[model samples]
Target: MWPWEHVAVGYIAYSLLSRTVVARRPGVPELFAVLLGSLGPDLIDKPLAWGLGVLPGGYSLGHSVFFAVPLALAAVGVAALAGRGSTGVAFGLSYLLHLPADVYYFVVFGDPPAYGILFWPLVPAAGGSIRGDLLSEALRYFTTFLADVTTPEAVPFLVGEALLLATAAFLLWRDTAARRRGRPEATTR
Candidate 1:
């Protein structure tokens, strides 16, 4: 999978899962924030790698479960203060979505230089310790499919990924618009 692939998949997963995970919650904007947060780890890593010649941070502090813990706790505190359990839960779901995506990326693509929070406190204390091999095989299959269908180069991957991302972006825009119109259910806070 490529960046666009991950983005598109993550967007779809967030859109679909957010509904169930944050159902009956208020604040569509906050829900979007959470959904964006779900992609925060990779989002952070990508920009840093492109510009600073380093990671989103020096290490995994931004992507690790250790970091999300404080965020989750903070959100909990906010909800407690506001007396809004539903809001807390919805925000928490966004953080929850982040973990699985990180786990899958790590399991398949390898740890992001030095970060792994797939299992959270369960997986030691270093960047990411648990290892996986099946993901590579799957990547191979995906690459093979790409090769079989088109030229074996970056263009094929890039084009496909772009289309995927564009579609997801459109859907997200649509979902957002629908929410704004107040014609359908959307997180309001």
Candidate 2:
């Protein structure tokens, strides 16, 4: 899945988890904080190649689990501090959720099958471009499979994304209503 898709799913997982586990203690920003934090490690590669005169792609330090994990943790920690315990926990969870997907994409499919146990030996040795056939296959299979099944597979994902967005919209509406009534987050709930 694309980074954006991961993020879209992450946001929903974050929101649903927030509502159930955190019981609305953490606001939407906290959940979103996690999604953004996880992307930080990979996003740098694009800038390095485009702006700072670096190679386009390789098994660089950024792709290293050592570097990415710590950075992602730091991002979540910062969000937690800024937002509070519930927010931080959600961000931290979301940040962690991105790893398996990243590993699958970068280590498993990104490498050639000929090589034996490369950078990430345990993984399947990821290879092929980001937009390559495998990704398309995975996308089509996953999405199609999801969109089928008695009712729909993508429905959960779609509904999850929509709910997250709806929460944000409600926040906006609440803010507007509050301003009109002269209060914020409204003590009245």
Candidate 3:
């Protein structure tokens, strides 16, 4: 999945979790935190792989659950101790969601889940060294993704993508409506 897709999924998950678990909507800061978390892995790994050649592929390092789980837990622990538990939850959920999104992306592409990428140093990345500079690589990536999305095989992925977008839009609309009505739920922390 793309970075924006990851953000959408993370936000949707965080929103639903907030509503069900805490009976509250997240504030703007929490939404930002979730977006940051959703892109955290790619922000770290992509440059290293495509630009610096420090890793085998974009799926190494931050993509690893071995790294993410402990890091997210530490964030939660620190946040809890600091009395910012909601921020912690937002970060942790968004960070964790990246892994499954990747898996789902592969599955939708008719490939097996590349679970080995989740262990990094403990397990090898599936691909060889990234070719070309970062700009070229990014262009190729987006172009290929666009091409793929236009195919019949991508119909299910497109459907899922629409649902995610709709969910995010609905949440935003609901929040806006509640705020206009002066509902306390609109101001949840």
Candidate 4:
């Protein structure tokens, strides 16, 4: 999935979880944490793979449960020490959500389930080097994605994704506006 797709899924999931499970809306810090966590895997692995040629692929260390679990736990632990437990949870949940989102994306596109990508060194990625630097690779991928989404077969999925993103964006905007107004629910930490 693309970065924006990851962010949309993370925001939607976190927003619902925060309201239903925690009985509160997320704060600005928690929102920022979710955004960071949503892109953390790609930010780490993509540079290592596409720019430095260090990793086997763009889904190696950062996408793996081995690294993700420990990292999330450490983040939570540190944040708890700082008296921001919810922020930590938000980051951890968003980070973990990224793996399943990628797997789901692959499956939705008729690719085999990408469960192997979550195993990292244990199973190894279907390693392939992308051409050029990270920016170039991203542009190329985006171009391909645009082409794919233009197809009749992809219309329904595209429309659904667009709507989901729009809703997420609106929710974020509402939350930010509420924060500016100092609303009680939106003023948490």
Give the number of the best model, judged by lDDT: 4
Error of 3 at 122 (Å): 1.8
Please give, for residues 37-109, the per-residue lDDT of candidate 3 as tens digits.
9998888788888888888888888899888999889878888899888888899889999988886678777
Question: What's the distance in Å from true for residue 37, model 2?
Answer: 2.2
Q: Tens digits of per-residue lDDT for model 4 on 1-189?
A: 988889888888888787778777789899999999999999889888877878888899999999999999999999999999889988998999999998778876778888998999998765455645877776777898888888889978888898989989987886777767777373355
Model 2 misses residue 154 by how many Å?
A: 14
Alpha-carbon lDDT of model 1: 0.53
Off by over 4 Å in 2: 55-59, 80-83, 105-189
Ranking by lDDT: 4, 3, 1, 2
Give candidate 4's error at residue 9 in angstroms: 1.0
Global lDDT scores for all candidate models: 0.53, 0.50, 0.81, 0.85
- Which runs of model 4 end up more than 4 angstroms from their true locations? 130-132, 186-189
Q: Which number leads on TM-score?
A: 4
Q: 3 or 4, which is superior by TM-score? A: 4
State each model's C-alpha RMSD to the native. 9.0, 8.3, 2.5, 2.5
Candidate 3 Cα outliers beyond 4 Å, as residue runs = 127-132, 176-189
Candidate 2 structure quality by residue, lDDT tens digits, 1-189: 356655654565665565566455234466456566556434544334333435233223344465556765675577567766555665556655555555544332333333221233233323222322434534554685455533654466557546756765564455446556665333345
Kindly indicate the candidate among 1 and 4 with the higher lDDT: 4
Clashes in candidate 3: how many? 0
The local distance difference test score of model 2 is 0.50
lDDT of 1 by residue, 2-53 (tens): 4445456656655666556754223565555455555565555433433343
Clashes of each: 8, 12, 0, 0
**Model 4 weakest lDDT span, ten residues long:** 124-133
Candidate 4 positional error at 37, Å = 0.1
